[model samples]
Target: MDRIRKIFLVSINNIRKWATNPRIYVLFILITMFLWSSIRPILSFSKEMGIRVTPWVFPHLASSFVGQLILMLGVVLLFCDAPFIDEGQPYFLIRSGRYTWGMGQVFYIMMGMTIYLLIVNFISILILMPNIFLSTGWGKILGTLAENHGESVNEIEYISKKILLSYTPLKAFVLSFILEWCAGTALALLMFVINICLNRAAGATIASLIILLDYAIYSNFPSVKFFYFSPVSLSKLILIDSKGISNYPSNEYAYIFFIITIIVLSIISVLSVRRKDIQVQPAV
Candidate 1:
């Protein structure tokens, strides 16, 4: 209980400091809101064209937002250098349980991500609902068009069905978090590896190379199960249709592959951190 309390206090203090930083949070909020707001027009346009939108749209936007969140979070972890030795007179000593401290950081990151996702989701739902109604209620306009074109209402039925079927918020959040955690952690690990290897610039180059390689392989040859290790591939697995993942009929295997890959990657990351040398250098 004492250890848990200590960890909680440490985490709380870290969050407080972060929260006090107004500029970063403000910019983050603005960018996310802007992205969420942009979807309104798209929803309106789709409705006008006799197309229905899916609730899946929210999660898709959320996924992209989470990706950007992960990227920013990675920069913070890498540049701030948490749980590692810092030369600036250790403010809070790990003293006994270093593992706890590391775990605390993990928990903090996950919590921060969850909160961010929830807030953005709430804003998106608020902004999108009325626009969706306007788009779908174009009954008279649609009727005139259908009569002129000699087409039946069945032409727009697919969109209507899609709108009705696609609003899986719970599923979207679960899938979004899973992909976000995997991608976020991977990026952080990559940044850590880069920091250890060739300074910031070199690490950026290597990380970019890795991302490109991951995308290239997944796009060209997805049949190989190992590609699931790549965050992009993992996101694809979550977002794309089961068969869309490399044409394999059974997606069960792909999911299993992703789980195993995430485990392996996580283990490797922990080991890397455990063995990493802590030496402060110029922040790049």
Candidate 2:
């Protein structure tokens, strides 16, 4: 109990220290405000042009930007100055139970993302709320519903009933938040692992080269079937609709594969930390 409390406090303090830093806060606020501002013009343009863009798309874009920001932060705070721990010296996490510290870090990141997503979601909803309300007239609503229906039963009416029954925008936002966060965190952890494995400059260059090579291969190769599992590829789903992808996995399969990949990578990370020696540096 005492150990858990200590780990939690340490994690909280670490996050707070990062948050309170003037440069970090400035960067975060600027990026967030920029993204918030973008939603209005996008929504207005979509409305004027009669584009069928989802209200969720703005938040999804904001989430991806946030993911990139978090990745930068992780690189700065966790790996920038890490040094090899000598056998004679006791590493902080090794002494404090590495697993607890690692899990605490993941929780801290998730919390940060949750707060960011909430802010972005709020801004997006503010932009779309007026449209949703004013467009509630029978004709407008019917038109919207008509656009949604296929050759089968009406999608708009069915969705309207669900909405009337209290499936509010807040609920939808929260559901999207969970899915986006899962996808983001999993990709971030995997990136961290790769970064650790490739600590040198040459290795970083090779990683970049490999990324370009893979892009070419995936586009040109006839047999590269599992590109969807790649972080760069899968992350696109958050912004673009599933239908927009050239090779998107089926809805059910994507979720299953994503969850499994995340779980497996998370497990591998934990095992590496437990058994492998990491020359992790301190956040400057």
Candidate 3:
């Protein structure tokens, strides 16, 4: 119990240190502003067309191309300087058990990513407040699609409408938020593992590339889409309707895969850190 408390306190201190860093907060706000600006035009167009928008629309937009670009960049920037890269690591490496230190780093990444998502999502809700309406089901929004059966709608719009119709507005919001959190956690853990094996820059670059590649492959090859492990896959898994309307894999399976991946990556990171020689210079 005492050891756990000590580790918790150490992790909290690390989180506080990170919280004091201006760059992370600055990047977070900038990303939020960029997302808001990008979505403003869409909201305006929706209003012009007399389309009833819901709060759930923002998550769909945030997961779009522009939104994904900003999100991936923000994540890379925010975590590119993980604790493993800090200078004078030998001194601190022995101060705490490697496992504890690794756990602290994990906690730090989780907290940072949570804050980033919350801020971005909060800003999105605020921007769409005027058009935001809580609906019990998708019947309200899908009416737009029904009215324009001949019009060609994009896959994103189709999926978003299906999600909104299948789930209540509040349920959609909570599910979307949970999916984002899970994806962020998985991504952060993966990057940390990469940082353990390679340098921070390489980790960040490769992590971002993995996400892009996953998206590209999933977009082009619908059959093998489920094989890739990326935030895009996680998001898509969450957006799948209960009736298998999207023809995607079940959420239960995807979630289980995410859990397994996180556990495997976390164990690998901890083991690597434990065996790593502290005599070498820091990567930072």
Candidate 4:
């Protein structure tokens, strides 16, 4: 219990800067930009048609094959500096040793990414709340857009019929949060492990590449066969077939994939802390 407490405290210390860092504003700005890109096309249509959407805009964005790419790209920009190495880290590492400190860093990444997602989700709800009323279902604008298959406007974002039928609005929001939180943690761990083994540039570059590949696969490949090659794609609930009848992966598959990836990466990170000569530097 004491060891766990220490690790929790260590994780808090690691993330404290993010709270104080002036760069936090950049994350807010990125959230706005990414959400705008996803919802902009439908915004005008909603206003013109006087559509009051439900407070379930998140799944609409997360379920979009392309919008998933944009949101994860925003994640990359926010947390690519995993292990968040700084001048103070060596002292902490020296005190806690490799295993304990590495666990702290891992916990920090998990908490950090979850908080980022929370902020993004909050902003998303606020955006919808202006004209939105409490509703437990997809409202008029989204229903019409889904019915028309998003051809009602030019390149609009949409929640597909499959997603609408498979999960209610509340379920969709919960699924989006959980899936995205897991995927973002995996991405942060990817950066931490690579940076520990190699360098920061390599870490950030590889993580960015994975997200770009997700976009490429959605844009060009358009097959569930390729989703395995891109970790970010695994987070998109839309691509995962709810009925188990489609070619896409199952929700169970996504949960298992994340569980396996996170466990493997967690083990590697803890083990490599002693052996890998990490000169991980801090970012502002």
Best by TM-score: 4
User: What's the best-to-worst order under TM-score?
Assistant: 4, 3, 1, 2
lDDT of 1 by residue, 72-178 (tens): 44334333333333443134434525455544444454455455555555666566565443333323433343244313332321122221233344554466556
Query: Which ranges of candidate 4 are over 4 A from the true structure?
Result: 40-44, 219-223, 278-282
Q: Which window of ten consecutive residues has the lowest lDDT sum in model 1?
A: 155-164
43 Cα displacement, candidate 3 (Å): 4.8
The TM-scores, one per candidate, come to 0.60, 0.56, 0.78, 0.91
Ranking by lDDT: 4, 3, 1, 2
Predictions in order: lDDT: 0.47, 0.46, 0.62, 0.78
Task: Report the lDDT tens digits of candidate 3 across residue range 95-127.
Answer: 777777776667667777777788787787678
Model 4 deviation from native, Cα RMSD in Å: 2.1
- Cα lDDT for residue 30, model 1? 74
Which candidate achieves the best lDDT against the true structure? 4
**Number of the candidate with higher TM-score, 1 or 2:** 1
The per-residue C-alpha lDDT of model 3 at residue 239 equals 38
Over 4 Å off, model 2 = 1-7, 33-37, 42-95, 123-175, 200-227, 235-247, 278-284
Span of 10 residues, lowest total lDDT, candidate 3: 150-159
Candidate 2 lDDT, tens digit per residue, 1-284? 97778557545655565554564555556655654554454445446556433454332342243333443343333322222222322444656676765555555445555555565556556666645433222233323433453112221122232222222334434544555565555545554455456553433343344334435645676653554544443433332234434444544555676688767866665565566567645333
Model 4 pairs whose backbones collide: none
